[model samples]
Target: MAVVCSKADWFVTSCSTTLVALNRKQSGEPFVFDCSKAEKKPKESDGDNKSAGEGSEEKDSDRILAFAISASGKHVVLTDDHKRLVLFCTEPSWKCISTRWVVRRCTSLAFTQAEDEVFVADKSGDVYSFSILEPQKVGELKLGHLSMLLDVTLSPDDKYIITADRDEKIRVSFRRSPYNIQAFCLGHTEFVSSLLVPAGHPDWLLSGSGDGTVKVWHYETGRRLHSVDLRKFGLDSENTEKRFAVSRIISSPDGQHVAVQCEGFPSVQLFAVDCGTEGLLNPADTLTLPLSPWDVTFDSQNQLWVLLESEDMNVLLYQHFEQHWRLCDSECPELKRITDALQTQWHLFKDSVELESRFKHLYKVNFDNMASYLQKKQERLDMENKKRAAANGTKPNKKSKTESGAVPHSTS
Candidate 1:
């Protein structure tokens, strides 16, 4: 997967195993870092060999789960499925500053507004705060939930830490006193997969869920403001039930527009931020994509950058202009360079285990579609049979005795 961090002055791209930082103006020496060489920190001594064995068995080796650059664009942090967290300094040199081990595999990473702390959320429902200023210090536990946390972010003012869990609960906790809960934004039927406090909307929250709805909420009052069902975009109840969760919801830098990407969908939904309509999200446009985006973000100029899930590792850019968004006329050279490097990496390891996994994923998708189609066909046949029976006025057959005391008519 290729991830791009587009800021005002520079853009950084991170493939599965490498990171490249390029300055937009200077085009100077690009800082390249091979993330595959990031060393994992040794696990703490539990004094139990059985527990150690269990942990080792569950660990996923060398798979990057999430990565993010700080708001200031000076620091970068990435977490892997093996429970390793690595922080990097992007300036002067692309150097790994620290490699810390976590208790469980991390699901999301967010940098604080001050850029002094990095918040890490793990599958075990715990959030840990790592002090970037004190690189030698280990991460300390901040707060936790009963369900697995899917995403976490801080309010614009940095006064509250909002977290979304797999149980459809979004909890807001005071940042200074995390133990004190502020409010709960509820109503999602399925897991709340993603959350965002859009720029300039400090009191509002936007969340996407497995239920196929993007809801707008008044976080401070815990009130449901409005919601837009993605099902309106051609998905039905059956399709939504097949676990197509909204993968990401991002607001543009200026906060005037928002983009939503759902799992298993190859198109991006765009909405305008309608503050006048009680903070509702108004439908703007939809950008049909060639492939499902692995990740999506908007640069300073409100150009949507989509990193595609493809063998070629392409990144598509769409510019917002004249109240509409459209693909750029020309390709970005910097993005092309990053994709070329990613393709090279893929070719060198085409026969590796990753290739096998990719094949398995593709097979699963095809198998699921075939199964769904067959199931629907069977359902249609059953409905038709019932209709036919009704039309024929068919009833249960009755058994009767014949004149010779023999059972002449019997129910089948």
Candidate 2:
């Protein structure tokens, strides 16, 4: 899938197996790193890990499953479909520092506040911690959940490790002792898909879920600050059979603006974060794109960068001017070059994402057993009432209630 995110002057985007990073200081030159050609550290390749990490590049061998740039924007780490944990340095130059192995296929990646450690969360409900200072060292198991983890993030000060799962729960655990959970930000009725602890707001945490709502929580206390229902804005699920899923939630570098992207929708919803103590959410404006978006993010300059579905000229830069967003793709000199680079492998992203079913089995299938049981009980009551009247040698009245005061069953 195509994805874009930025911190400070660094602009990073990924498609298929290649991640392109463009620093404003290094204009016209985007650092493109392909994971297929990556090499493991010295003597790190052992016998047990030879099958997944070491192999000839097959179809979808190097496809990036999850990736994240560090808080300082100086490093990036990504896990591929082949179970390789690849880390890159960004400040001096975009270079792959390490390619480690994960026990299971990773679902999400996160960096500590110091950016010295990288956290890898897999679909098997386990999270592994890898050292950034010691790139060649193996990873250590940090924590695990009972259900599949969808997103992982840390508090601004690195005090707590927050994780969301397939079971509609957000767990806050101590970073030093993950087994000791701090709190759980509960109330989402479906799987939590994305999480964001906005910049400049250490106490606030923003979460998006398949329940079609965006909620704000005070991470330390696990108190819900506020919530916004996307359905009120007419942002329903494209699949009528399923509930709406908030695919991504991103914030501007200043945390003054938050944008929400729903799965299967071609539009982006923007929310203005208040300056008050509660940091309330107010609807700003919803911008509809021409095509479905693979991902969206905000640049450090507070401009929204949208990676659309189209292959050619897929990158769009929307400038917020005069209280509304205006198209200014031409003004961005790096867009054409980035689009040109992505065009070659656009089909790979399109084909792979199209075939992947993200939210197929998430909806709950409820059986109303109470109603069925009550119906059967009433029928039994009527049958017994009739038998008693027949034994008494008298016609039973249809409206007569039994000694138990149960209503007669309707047979129509």
Candidate 3:
């Protein structure tokens, strides 16, 4: 299922072939972008037939893969399975700025600190930089990894372009000189699924991995600071390694707190950054989810927003009151309006989330080769015994124990 991707005041949710964005500051209608309705257009530069406006057939796989809201919150970008990178401008009104194409289906997209350039990370392990100023321009190959990249983000100063991959490594490189390697954040035993440079903490980086822990890092130096194991906070019955991978890591606007969500798990683990040590992760609270969460984010007001698997009450808002998160689902009418608008295509959201559990295969499976080999050897010996008994003229009752219901001995 598609997850809700948000930054600042605007929170957006995408499903199969469409996306909905709403500004919390206004009661205006949510902007709906449907790939099925997007018409393919010719690029002015190379006449490449990409799409921007609506009304044309798209692929069945043309679902939104990743999206990002500019740090300034004025621009929004999302990549779809159709290899189309769609951009939107929020001010003056929500408008489609351009439709560009990526070399491969993107796994993550991020706007630089300046929002002048957007980086696209694809399954091919390559990142392409697209120009926001020159919306019609094609992307330039930036840098790449040896394995599929799952998440990409820029340092707060836009000095470093950090990327995490399925091979369990986070590479930090110079944004201007992509080949200038800064450092690598290593330690995750499984695929890294999400990355974030928390607000107000430029030197610090937070990453979530399939191994079930979120690690804090100093991006420039590649120093590991702290880590949080989400399994310790999930539902008691759901503490197995299978429910581990940290799917999303979000910081409150003030950067005082960070929230971590595990895929297919029913809890959001909150952490207080720099609470005890200067640069450390401290467990604060675990927001018990009634259902598995799709994503979590903190709006400009520091209110926590959670998108769940349920269609009836798809979005929930929480306020940090008295050192704990208090529910405001029925109290916030603005959020209520957004939830009502999403209810129509809510099934799409549900279906999108169901498809996201594809990571379970990333774990290793077990097999015993020795047991099978020993059993075959014993069967061969029994066959020879049966033949010798037939030639010795022994009664058929002495059938070499071949026809008997005797259990075979298993060796350690």
Candidate 4:
């Protein structure tokens, strides 16, 4: 497929099977012929389009179900319907390099920042990692979630991998040696169809589920940060009910917004996030796409690329600007209390030095650090007791208790 990534004034769309690049630069005759023909397909031919050597068997190798472009845009990793892995590099004039079979239909694929490695998750809950530079598979991690792997993604720092599965489980794994399982985020009651990591925050993960909820988590700590019900987001009403499932989620390049593409919704919905904090998606400021989309991407220029998976199968490029600010939800009392306690504790620590000056330092001690300081003081008391006991020829109470097989009694 010829992936389209354009600026704000330019948009690319497939019109009547023709890939047309439209330019809004000029209002009068604002259309540019970047590539008038969809190069991925050949010109209409009589039923004899398939030659003896180049037939359906070869076309099967050409059809790309899912793909990921390298960060450098030098390589494109693709998986075909036949569970075959392929890489198309620019150096060889768009040639497909068949690497290995994933054994099952691939649900998702991700390329690490290094662009040398690719991670593929199949329907069988098995994740395979391979080097694009090497033909051999490097590693494999199996998540025991007994369902299809909906989406797999690597952390921005490349230190961790996360997979969302049909069993409503999100499995996190360390990227390096042993590939130890980190944490399982479990809240979605149905299949989680999409996994996303925001650009600015390396610790946060987002999963959209068929259960009609979008869940967020701190991947490192396995703490669920937020959960937004799609029904509560106002898309579950009787008249404007959403028929399509959420297929993909993509964060804005600036990390201030997130776009979720659904199967039956109007289009990709853009959501705003609070600045300076890893904010969750809010109900307000939702931007609808031109059509129901299956995949979404925010490119280098901040333009939204939406893949409509209908019969026409046109890729819509939206250049609208979304204000990236999250509106704090007032209903979450627990989160409010936790955030308030944190803020108060933060201010207390910030004013610690000034507070110490108002009273005797007592070895720089205070309630905030009292527990450890008190433990040390108790150790001194225990040592003094031991010395007195030794001088008086008294057996240590702990030792006596052990000998007597009874609990010890000592004030110290």
RMSD of each: 9.0, 6.4, 5.5, 22.4
Per-residue CA lDDT of candidate 2, range 1-412, in tens? Answer: 6777777678777777877776644545567777778764345544454564433443336777888988778888888877889888875667778778887778889899898898889887888899999998999999999888999998888888899999999999999999999899999999999999987788899999988889999888889999998987767645445476898998887778899999887789998889785959899899888888888988778888888777665778787788777778664665555566556556546644555547656656689997888678777777887898999998865644444355667888
Whole-model Cα lDDT of every candidate shown, in order: 0.76, 0.81, 0.80, 0.57
Question: Among these predicted structures, which one has the highest TM-score?
Answer: 3
lDDT of 1 by residue, 1-412 (tens): 5556676556776655556666655545666665456774554443332353335556456666778888867898888755678888877656789887776778888888898898999877889998899876878999999978989999988888899988789999988889999999999987888899998788899999877899999987789999888988764545544556787899988889999988767789999998787778989998888866767888777778887766654667788878899786435675565455555545423322232211122111325786677667666666666677788998423323342234466689
Query: lDDT by residue for model 3 over 1-412, one digit each (tens)?
Result: 6677666668787877888887776676778888866755345622233242222454426778888889888898988877789999988788999998776778999999788999999987999999999998989999989988999999988888999998899999999999999999999888888999988888888998888788888878888988776656643454363446778889987988888887777778888777557568878888887888777888888888888767777888888999888889565787787787778667556547465475776654568887777677667666777687799976433433434434667789
Which of the two, 3 or 4, has more lDDT? 3
Output the better candidate (2/3) by TM-score: 3
What tens-digit string does per-residue lDDT give for candidate 4 at 297-317? 666666565544333333444
Model 1 residue pairs with clashes: none
> lDDT-based ranking, best first?
2, 3, 1, 4
Off by over 4 Å in 4: 1-63, 91-93, 136-145, 239-244, 288-290, 309-315, 321-412
The alpha-carbon deviation from the true structure for residue 275 of candidate 4, after best TM-score superposition, in angstroms, is 3.2
Q: Considering summed lDDT, which 10 consecutive residues are worst modelled in model 4? A: 355-364
- Superposition-based RMSD of candidate 3 using all C-alpha atoms, in angstroms: 5.5
TM-score of each: 0.79, 0.82, 0.85, 0.60
